[model samples]
Target: MEKIARQGLLYDFYGALLTEHQRHVYEDVVFYDLSLSEIAEEQGISRQGVHDLIKRCNKILESYEEKLHLVEKFEQTKKLAREIQSLTKAFSENRDMGLIHRIEEISGEIVELEAH
Candidate 1:
């Protein structure tokens, strides 16, 4: 994944765990696309301080993902759900038994994922 996109996903999955101060600074940098100097000026902190905080926030978010695997499971489940939707549509259009089987298989996979 691209760096920005990866960061966004990590933030989405783990951002709520951050302290309010960390969330404000990290959101300014990641979500608002503010430069470190800009965030520093606005927050009345040093530029280096903003940079370090952002880095620490990123590390913390990544550690949460590494331990919990929620982000990974979410992505996988999303992909499987899309596939199931596509299979359902195809089955509806063609009334194909093969499509039905595929949809069932995908549903089973989704169930298995949720169980974990």
Candidate 2:
């Protein structure tokens, strides 16, 4: 489930770079987690068409990620956020002053990434 969420985020990041048609079908099927039949009905296409468009869009998005690495950077940001959360939790429980400072720094870094 966690892996799915991570992949979904990466897909969304890469999806922003796709064409409108690709975005329409890909967003419906992937980001919304809709079934092929559901997407087909919504998009006025056959199930097979939706499936093929999704497959092609996936390839395009993957290619974009391979070259631009935005999705990779986004994943790294997610991992960093998790690590910062853990650090914050530990500092809260232990009242470690040094850990508090580190957490604050990391939190700032995560916020900066959010801007990008």
Candidate 3:
């Protein structure tokens, strides 16, 4: 993934674990696309401080992902859902038993993933 998109995913998955102050700064940089200097000026901190804070936030969020794997599971589930949708559409269009069987299998896999 691209750096910005990866950061956004990390933030989405683990942002709630951050302190209010950390979230504010991280949102400014990642969501609002603010420069480090801009965030520092607005928040009354040094530019280096803002940079370091962002780095620390990244590390913390990544640590959460490493331990929990929620993001990985979410991505896998989403991909499976998309595949199921496509299989359903194909079955509908062609009345194909094979496509229906694939859709059923994918749905079962999605259910099993969620059960865990």
Candidate 4:
């Protein structure tokens, strides 16, 4: 995944791990689209220092995702949720018991996947 995407997912799950300054610098540079020089000027740090801090923040975010696998799990959960939604729509529109039953089965599978 891209650094920003990875950081977003990690932040959703574990943002409290970062220090306040790290959080501010990271959010400004990565999410707010502030230029490195601008971020350095705003934060009273050298541009190189800002660049390095952002790098370190990226590493920290990536490390959490790698260790916890939250991003992967969330992706899987999202796919399963979509499947369930589709099946629910099919069940409502078509009234196919077999399809509904299949959806139920898949829902069971999703629950089982979540349990681990």
- In order of appearance, the predictions have TM-scores of 0.94, 0.64, 0.96, 0.87
Per-residue CA lDDT of model 3 for 50-74, tens digit only, reads 9999999999999999999998999
**lDDT (tens digit, per residue) of candidate 2 on 1-116:** 47556557657677667788878777777677899999889889999999888778767766776787876777678888888889888987998899878878888888888777
The Cα RMSD in angstroms, rounded to one decimal, for candidate 4 relative to the true structure is: 1.6
| lDDT of prediction 1 | 0.93
Q: Which prediction has more favorable TM-score, 1 or 2? A: 1
Error of 2 at 19 (Å): 2.3
Instruction: State the displacement of the C-alpha of residue 62, model 4, in Å, after optimal TM-score superposition.
Output: 1.3
RMSD for each of the candidates = 1.1, 3.9, 0.9, 1.6
Those runs of model 3 whose alpha carbons end farther than 4 Å from true positions after fitting are none
Question: What is the per-residue lDDT of model 1 for residues 1-116, given as tens digits with 9 covering 90 to 100?
Answer: 89989999999989999999999998889899988888999999999999899899999999999899999999999999999888888888999999888888999999999998
Q: Which residue runs of candidate 1 sit more than 4 Å off their true CA positions?
A: none
Error of 1 at 102 (Å): 1.0
lDDT of 1 at 32: 93
Clash counts for all predictions: 0, 0, 0, 0
Pairs that collide in candidate 2 are: none
